[model samples]
Target: MTDKPLGRSAVYTVLTTGYTTSTGPGVAATVSYVSDRDRHVIVDPGMVAHRDRILGPLAELGLGPDDITDVVLSHHHPDNTMNVGLFPEAWVHDHKAEYRNDQWTDRDAEGHQLTESLRLIRTPGHSPEDITLLAGTADGVVAFAGDLWWRPDGPAEDPVAPDRDDLRTSRLRVVAAADVIVPGHGGAFPAGEGVPL
Candidate 1:
């Protein structure tokens, strides 16, 4: 993979399942990912519902499960990691602080260092397994905050997020570290020295 700039390459919001179908906005799962050469890395595989809609965007980018090199899970919650089992071939990455061993390979850091262009950060709040992937090409920091933050209002924003305390500490990490934040289900949030959000 040649050295390149890192930014959001994908996102998938699927309908919720179980009792969630009755109340609250539908759940969403985002794929904060990037590609290098032919290999790809994905973060948080939302829900199994509307599978085609979930994976279709990637297909448009000419990506498939076989092309993925790593699958990083931000948390073990059903909405964020339910689809992980589908990618047995990819190296599954997640924070052991929250998730348990299963079919995918695991890691403790927030962003696993795949190359000089990548690094994962353990920004727990949304879940014990909560993590934020940062991309900086020996230059700057780009944050991918999984459920650690999200859109305030959306019909499909099922944020059964962990207590705000986790979200709070996680936000602290974001403030201390991130440059540009790609929140799970919201518009982009720029991280900086401004007053806390």
Candidate 2:
């Protein structure tokens, strides 16, 4: 009920700025690293030009795959989930559950708090199982919205959305809650720029 962030020190870094081609075969999911309290979270460790595109930056940050505590997937698309095996030790979070080695704990992503400042919100429509990771930082809330948009300039409409209304509603919710948005396939942008109304 408060507009204030949870007052925890959360830091986020976009390890790889992703891209998608209009003409041919090239794409990479934008990946991010968030650290809050005891949690080292990776958002969308998906397809990249190379594994080093993901691991190299992580190495630069002094973290190995073993150091990660959680991996959050916005949805199940292969492009957004290919490199998940890189972090074998982290619990994987999706819209409906958390998975680790041999465990699958079912839980709703809505309002699922991973840390004081990091939480999950169900934002279906990019896919029915889509979820967004909200990280509360000193600047404001940062919404890691996978395919909810391919980029800052949204597709205007998601061609493959099962429910366009749901996609729009989800987008509005994210726009309302986040000061910055890191799209699934592009660099982060301020919430106000070319956001779908």
Candidate 3:
């Protein structure tokens, strides 16, 4: 798994699993970002190998269970939300229409924060929770697409107009205008396929 920080925001994402695995070609990550002063956020904290063997990376990051600022889950997949409870102080954020949002408040009791991160892209072919996150960062505007669009080896794999036809519409209404794309599992990509965003 790869671990690195994005820019200078203290927002760190460590690859917990990868498509490189012999079992499959899907990548998973444990996403953490600092929301405010001394407040850190975590997302999709999972195990790298045996599912039972979790809770090590958090310590490696010098973070304790109660140090997390929030837990922003992209969807309901266990690979992304399994170790959520390990951080007792985190306020969990996710789509309410699709996933249970109240669980975080009850679990943490410090209140929870919600975001449009799951922008209702409606990319159903991937999954009901296959959504994305649109937020402004120090770098610039971006869309954190969970699995809406992916990079193909060539343009053949590139998402064409209305590429999300598999789930519902013959095409996506509009992808959020942004500078970059922080996909859920894959590495970030130039937004608009490298247009002047």
Candidate 4:
């Protein structure tokens, strides 16, 4: 519903229809955009249901579908990857462990540099293929955490993650590596400042 700036990139949280509560929607997804010197990169295109909402923000930023050079999936969840088809020309990257599709290539274990300042880290936790995109900007290290942590007010634990241990480990790694964290479902927050355990 709101787009916030995280370093050089912008974080857009899209509310999807699923379980709704008085507090908020039970499920929400995050889509982020990082502008490199040459082209723009989209992280987690979000669900098909929220395609228009996603594209509108991009348009406001003067970036069309064709301007996006890459689409990175943090994981293979429907909410995270459903809109991938919208960008046919962009290179899609995912963990080879989960997606074996020939069209999707594997992200390096060490990490892949999408731009001079943006890097992709394989931080599997919420899913076997979960990854966190780290970008060095004027602000600091901004981490786009895909389901690594759910809500900003909630605990670091992700209720949906099958492996709690893995989630915990990944959460710590993200916190240690990032100054600002763009969570999968909420607004971006400072790392290790007011985050719950």
Sort all candidates by lDDT, best to worst: 2, 4, 1, 3
Q: Write the per-residue lDDT of candidate 2 for residues 95-174, one digit (tens) a residue.
A: 98999999999999998899889989989988999999999998889999999988877787777789999999999888
Clashing pairs in 2: none
| Each model's total of backbone clashes | 9, 0, 6, 0
> What is candidate 2's CA lDDT for residue 83?
97
Against the correct fold, how does model 4 do in TM-score?
0.80
What C-alpha lDDT values do all the predictions have? 0.58, 0.90, 0.43, 0.66
> For model 1, which pairs clash?
98-128, 98-129, 110-120, 110-121, 110-122, 111-120, 111-121, 112-120, 125-166
Q: Which stretches of candidate 1 lie over 4 Å from their true place?
A: 1-25, 37-39, 97-107, 137-140, 152-165, 192-196
**Candidate 4 residue-wise lDDT, 1-197, digit = tens:** 11222335433323232221122334546777876666467777765345776788788887788877877788888767778777766877776422222554444634666665777777877888788878777777778877776557645555667888887777777887888887666667888777754
As a TM-score, model 3 comes out at 0.56
**Candidate whose TM-score is highest:** 2
- TM values, all candidates: 0.69, 0.95, 0.56, 0.80
Model 3 local distance difference test score: 0.43
Instruction: Choose the strongest candidate by lDDT.
Output: 2
Off by over 4 Å in 2: 2-5, 22-24
* Candidate 4, run of 10 with poorest lDDT: 14-23
The global Cα lDDT (0 to 1) of model 4 is 0.66
C-alpha positional error of residue 101 in candidate 4 after TM-score superposition, expressed in Å: 11
